[model samples]
Target: MLDAVVVGAGISGIYQLYRLRQAGLSVQLCEAGDGVGGTWFWNRYPGARFDSESYTYGYFFSRELLDEWSWSEEFAGQPETERYLNHVVDRFDLRRDIRLGARVSAAVYDDAAAAWTVTVENGERLRARFLVTAVGPLSEPYVPAIPGLAGFAGVWHHTARWPREPVDLRGKRVAVIGTGSSGVQVIPHIAAEAAELVVFQRTANWCTPINNRPITPERMREIRRTARTIHRTCQETPGGFVHRPLSVSALEVGEEERRERFQRLYDAPGLTMVLANYRDITTDRAANAAVTDFLRGKIRERVKDPEVAERLIPTDHTFGMKRPPLEDGFYEVFAQEHVSLVSLAEEPILRFTPAGIQTAARHYEIDVAVLATGFDAVTGAIRRIDIRGRDGVRLDRHWEAGPRTHLGLQSAGFPNLFFVGGPQSTTGNIPRATEIQVDWVMDCLRHMADHGHRYVETTPAAEEAWLAHVESTVRGTVLEDATSWAFGSNVPGKPRVYQLYAGGIPQYRARCAEAVEAGYTGFVFG
Candidate 1:
């Protein structure tokens, strides 16, 4: 039996393995895909890139690794991101312990033995003292139950499960669905090549232009020189990134000054315009409208047709509430002669014909349909495995109402099991969040070892309090107003409750620190 078994060979799992080995534990990782890079590995869709700057989006544990590997772009694309992860795996020599193309089917705790027996799809059973699920929050791809989808003779693909070889869209008619981050990014690229591109948007999304540019060698040198400072900045911020600090609320600024500030952020790169520029963009309605109006104006200005522009404007939710997507020429892409925008809200898709999709309004013939529909988010991947805890209590039944996680790290009934960057945690910059959770798990394990304890799990009472705390943190925020994936609202029949801890990363870190100082107050060890 191994000391620990980790599920999912993404960045989180990679770090978990690295740290576990450092602690002199025997650990093994199983991945569903054929390689490392978890989400990046599966999501090879065109135009997929990090919203956060490349420098701020990587692992923070190794300075040597940081100094050695270099990024080619400020906002790295999927290919580059995959390359970086592959580099990390090679640099750390982490492949020997990782079993690729092995998807975990079930993990059941042996209460008497105080261990877990994990079963994979390949009929392999592995026993471990502790099971750590590093399976990504956005790992599960969601395909909507559209009627007659199987009837479509044309090729269809989900963004999450895009083929390794590029799909040839040039001179081909393509239909794209969903206007979330991935859809927004993919549309522009598709519009560039597709002979006729039709976009099916269920809801319009808030999008800001990305100031994407190449990272020069000189810039790399400067980053290396002040690498410590950059890493420190990441730690100090709420999100694990360095960007514009909005000291005053949006209402505090004068009209001209507000426009100027918005303009400056709009001109700048990454998430500055929506997430970092205004303090009250997500909190206060009036402030959010101010930013919303500016973004809507930008969209209207870019797209030539007023009706099309209005169709693209999102009025249902507050700005920055639904995860705002950063884009390049996304708004402008609609103006292309070959492009057409199909509003699903206006005309719901009835079914798919043998040749194409048939909406209530009309049917459009297309060679390929790409479903950029988002994932099942945090809880989906975990529930995919038949995880049974105390007395064989199913994880699905436990989370049937919604996910209940103490600090998003452990469930109440599951002993000797842990989750890294799981649901109900402050899930911002993923690598940073992963580092925090992995470090905490290591600390908890060490504490258990030092105390001669064998079992650890969150108490029901503690789990309840944490869930309450999560609700309180996100109660009045814009995140609560939307039917977005943030609230598990994207997938039909999924619970409408807020599943993510909306509290800032810094605050979450402080709370985690307090728990450690107070003997991991939310958890119980035996």
Candidate 2:
């Protein structure tokens, strides 16, 4: 039996495999896709790019890798990110251990042996002492329950499952449903090409400019020169990525100063500036209102039609609560003569016709349709696997109410089964967070080895405490009030729990450190 069987060969899985090997453990990673780069491999949608800056978006374990690999842009697009992952795999010689196109159907723990039997699609079974699920939180694409979707004569695709070939949108009438991050990113690109573009918005989202640009050789030299300082800054910041954190509350600033700051942030590249600049923007409703109003004004200025601008402006949730999209000309897309906006909130989608979608108002004919709807998130990917633990307890049945894990790493019944980037874990600067998680999991595994422990699992009490702590972290905050995929609000019938840990990276890192210092507190080893 292998020491561990890791599900999903994404960034998390890749790092986990490396770390496991370093610890002298026999490990293998199974990826469903024909290639590596899990999310980047699948999501080839137009305008798809990383929200995090390119420099910090990669693995931090190897300084050699850091020095060798260079990013082309400030924000790497899907292709570039995928290429980077491929490079990492090639550099590490990880392909030999990874079984691509091997989709794990189920994982069941055998109490007697203290090992997991992982069954793949072709009825092949692999035994492992431990099961590490690096299956991403946002891996599962959520298709909305639209009636008569299959009957559509025209071609349609979800942004997550876009075709490998370039979609010919040139002069074709297109309709994009849902205006989340993917929608926000994609709408601008297609708007330029489509003969007529119709965007259906359920809830208008807050958008910031993605001032993406090429990274110069000089920039890379500067980064390499100050790599230590940059790494330190990344760790110190609340969110994982290095940014200018808010030292002062928004309420403290004067109207003119605040407006100017907001405008400057608006002009700046990336999604975090406005939200991360002011501490009170996410806390105080009035402070959030000020930022929202400024953004709304900017939208009004960008879009020519006042009505269309107003329709695009979001007032439902406070800023930073929902997924903040970074895009250039996303708001301005409504101003294009060929593009039209249809607010689903104003008039709900009635049904889908063969030609196109039909709303309460009218039927809009389109040659192609794009579903930019997001994922079930956090628990979806993990739950999809038929994971039966001790006493035949299924992970899905256990987490039926919502996902509950001790430190978002290990569940109670699932001994020797671990999760990275799972529910209740911090997703701030995903790669940074993933590295931390992988390190933590590796440490725990090494501890098990040193102690002669065959089985390891978190106590039920610990899981409860962690779940409660996670809920408490978001309680009374603007994040708690917002209904987005981050909180499992996008999928119908999914429990509306705060899946991600709201606690900043620094605090989370410290907490994990403290737990390790206390001999891996709350975990039972046998």
Candidate 3:
């Protein structure tokens, strides 16, 4: 038996375990993977890296950890990010309690036991007073329904489940499916190696330049000096990433002024336009069109081939509604002699032949197919496991409509069960949200201990009300215009409701504070 069992070894899970241990709790972190890094640990495609700036996309809890670890690029790649996470684990000596390669198959709470009985796939059983799920929002790999994908004779891998051994695509044809963030980032790198690369893209997202460069000693120093300010700025800002701090909405600005602002921010690169577009894009369809049109034009101008460029434009959805993708020289890769953009819309992939994939338009032969198809997002991780609470109510059935929890942490039926960076929390950049949420969970659990509460859970009524609030919050926003993982629209038959609180990080932090002030509102203690 342990005080807490965290069901992930990702960054959030690492933070949760470290904080809980610091709070005098005995914690055991079980991970399905053999090692740490969670999503980073797994996603090892060519050129997979963090799009968000590295200096900010990291843990803020330990100033020492931040200062001690160094990044290879302005935005750290997957390998370096994983290395940093491992470094933190070693620095804190946090590996003693973490059991790797042990996938938890079931976690059930017996009312009489007042503890969670966790059963692993290997028949190992453990009990814990508190259950924390650090399964990331983007943890689950989602391969689209491409026919005969299983029978492909050559190499096939998802970015999420990259092979440990090196893959050789030197003179072989390579096809990459899904041009989302992963595809955008990896395509150029893959195209450089593949004899000929075909990118089968369904939708074209607004791709911004990474503007990624090596982090200088001078730059690191400046960021370290202003770490507090950056954290504050991110908390106050709409997106988790630190961008323009805006007090006024853009709708209030005159057309000329707004266009000028848009021009300036658009040139600025990566998420600048998001805050600039914050004014009326969600409310004013014209405003949304103006920005989307600008992006479409930008994408069109980048590709060498006009026909290919036209196919890349996202006609249906507004910008930023779908998780905004940021990349460098993505469209330019199509100009390369080795690269070809396959329009999945016009010529849908019919099936995969034994040799390679085939579309209605052509029978292209390839040695490898890289599935950049993103995760099932928010709910997939939790759904992968059997979680039962209160009278053996299965979590799968409970979340049939969508995930429901108070403050994205504790579920109503499962007393002592906590989730870090889960549904109903900020889904932008996670490191920032992880810091705030971890702090709150730690403080809440401490409060429970101090008050001599043996058990605590969200009230059923409170969970329903909170779920409704999450759904309603995005109703008026531009997110409703299309299917996004944030709204659980990307995955087929998944609930249409959003998984994040869309109310900005500051408001989320404030509500959490208020909940603590109000004795953990929407929750009950015994």
Show the colliding residue pairs in model 1: none
Off by over 4 Å in 2: none
**For residue 274, what is the lDDT in candidate 2?**
53
lDDT of 1 by residue, 1-526 (tens): 9999999888889999999988999988999999899989999988999998888888768889988988999999999999999898888888888999999999999989999999999999999999999988898999999998998999999999999998999999999999999998888888888999999999898788899999999999998888888877877776778764688999998989999989999999988776577777888888888988888888888889999999999877757787788888898888889998989888999999999999898889989999999999988999989999999999999999999988888888999899986898846677777788899999999999999999999988888998999999877877667788878888999988888777877888888899999978988888
Score residue 314 of candidate 2 by CA lDDT: 85
lDDT scores in order: 0.88, 0.87, 0.82
**Deviation from native of the Cα of residue 438 in model 1, angstroms:** 0.2
C-alpha-based local distance difference test score of model 1: 0.88
For candidate 3, the per-residue lDDT at 486 reads 75
What ranges in model 1 sit over 4 Å off?
Answer: none
Q: How many collisions between residues are there in candidate 3?
A: 0
455: Cα error in model 3, Å: 0.9
Which pairs clash inside model 3? none
